[model samples]
Target chain A: MHSFFGKQLPVAVAFFSGVLMIITFFSGDQTVADFSQEQLVWVTIVGGFSLLLGVASITRVSLSDVRKRRKGWPYKAVLLIFLVASSLGAIIEGTERGTLYDWLFQNMNAPMMSTMFSLLAFYIASAAYRAFRARTVEATILLITATIVMLGRVPLGELIYGKLPEITDWIMNYPNLSVQRGIIIGAALGAASMSLRIILGIERTYLGRQ
Target chain B: MNHDIVLFLEMTLAGFLTLCIFSFLYKDNPFYRLAEHIFAGLSAGYYVGLIWHSVIMQQLWVPITQNGQYSLILPGLLGVLMFTRLVDRLSFLSRVSIAFVVGNTAGISIIQQLHGFVLPQLGDTMSRFGQEFWGPLIILIGVVSTLIYFYFSKEHKGALGITAKVGTVFIMVSFGAHFGYTVMGRVSLLIGRVQFLFVDWVHSFNKIIN
Candidate 1:
């Protein structure tokens, strides 16, 4: 019974939904197509719940850390406080302008998040310093290309060299476009094949096994 | 009068939070840790409220009540079933939700991947082979060579070896261009933060003092 409910049932569900979606796409009937579109919206609604699952996981982990008095228990405690407070504030206020949720989101969340990403610039420079080795032919090409493109992109590069922008455009439009197309083609093929596998139950990793 | 005071406080808090994040550049200390925790907690909480309003109220509740679309109830129930994972005995029920979402994505993606990415990319690459012959020829060479590089079924020897090596150069150049663009984007974000700090924060501070 457990095996049927836990694993087999889910696999069957996947097969049913997968087949239904494909049929709807190819079906000339308007009703089936409409149902498929509605089902897609259902999928989206279901997906949102998955994010709530993430919140549950975080809360559980943070609660455990605080309960156990872990190394950063004080921070965990602070996290819990903010989590509860922000949630209540937002739920009550509805995220509208002049609401506590909106103010906190704009003032606190936006600033902290943007600053965090901006800090990545400094680290990326350090990373580039370590990674930009030109020992091989490919490495030399990469280093030169990166340097040109980077220099060509900025206003400072235009001040330094008149042709940088034009050269940058050529590289981006030609070789970059070609490689990007190849990558897109490859990825699309891979995705289609993987989807087929999952539909056929050949891939069961999502079911908690290899 | 009170609104002005709140605005001042908001700007001051945002500036202080921005500094807290930047403090990580020097070293990971208490300030950075505090900011990180606060950000994570609030973001998670914000998601809960966002979903409660956007998905539950808007998608499920309003649709059912106002539009009399009772079909949404099934997906809503499926979403609620996702919470069953919290219980040991009924955890298997959550897989039903996962299966539906995954299956839906797989089916849609199979068609999307083929129609949106694969066919369009192939068409674009193939169609560009007129008028500007050399440019398109270079693209073709880059694409074919790059694809050959990824084809690991056959051992690289002689002609294949040379083509694969050429592929590596194209790949490297493309990668370098991508990295440069990414860095530029991060730098732009960095500039935004710096402008906020220098202009907005400083002006606000100056106003407060005056």
Candidate 2:
């Protein structure tokens, strides 16, 4: 009974849902299309509920830490307080655009996210300096290409060389585009095969087992 | 009470949070940790609110109640079933919900990947061949050679080895170009932060002083 409900039922459900979606894409019938679209909406709603699982997990972890008086438990407490306060504020306000929710997002969340991302610039610069050594032919080509693209992308390149932008454009349009296209095709094919595997029930990894 | 005063306060708070996040570059400290925790909690709360309002209320609840689409109740039930994973005996029930998501995504992606990515990219690559001489030839060589490099079924030797080597060069150049572009993007983000600090915050301060 466990295997019947756990393994077989789930696989059947997945196969049915997947086939319906594919049918929706190909079928010209408005009724079928609408039904499929509605089903997709249900999938999205189900996906959204998964977020609650995450929140629950976090809450459980934080509460356990607080109870244990763990190191950095104070920070965990602060996190939980903010989490509860912000959620309550949003729920009470009934809209994210409401005063407290909007303010917290704009003042706290946005700035931190932007600043954290911006810090990557410094890290990338340091990494490039360390990693982009001209050791071999391949490395030298990479270094040269990186230098050209970097210089051509900014005003400094034009200040040094008049034709840098033109060369950069040529490289981007031809060789870069070709390689990008190759990669796209390869990745698309790979993804399609994986999707097929899932649909055919050959891939049961999603069921939490090999 | 004034709008300008409100704006100034918001900008000041944002700038302070931004600086706190940036302080991580010096070393991990109390200020950075506070900002990080606040950001995480607030963002998670915001997402929860958003999912409830936008997805659940708009898509599921409204359709079921207002439109009398009672069929949606099934998927909603499936979504609720996802929580059964917390229970030892009923944990298998969660597989049904996951199956729906996996199947739906796979079905949708298969056709979209083929139509949107694979075919168009191949067509574009082939179409470019007759348009120009050297440019197209170079692109063709790059694409073919790069594809060969990615083909791991046959071991590289003799002619295949040289082709794979050429493919490696193209791949390296492509990677370098991508890295350079990413650096430029990150630098631009950093520039935006600097501008916000120096221009917007400073100007606001001057306005208050005046």
What's the lDDT for candidate 1?
A: 0.88
Q: Docking category for candidate 1?
A: medium
Off by over 4 Å in 1: B2-5
Q: Measured against the native two-chain assembly using Cα atoms, what DockQ does each of the candidate structures obtain, in the order listed?
A: 0.79, 0.74
What would you estimate as the lDDT of candidate 2?
Answer: 0.85
TM-score of chain A for candidate 2? 0.94
Assess the local accuracy of residue A125 in candidate 1 as a C-alpha lDDT between 0 and 100: 90
lDDT scores in order: 0.88, 0.85
Q: How high is each candidate's TM-score? A: 0.96, 0.95
Winning candidate number (lDDT): 1
- The 10-residue segment with the lowest total lDDT in model 2 chain B: B123-132
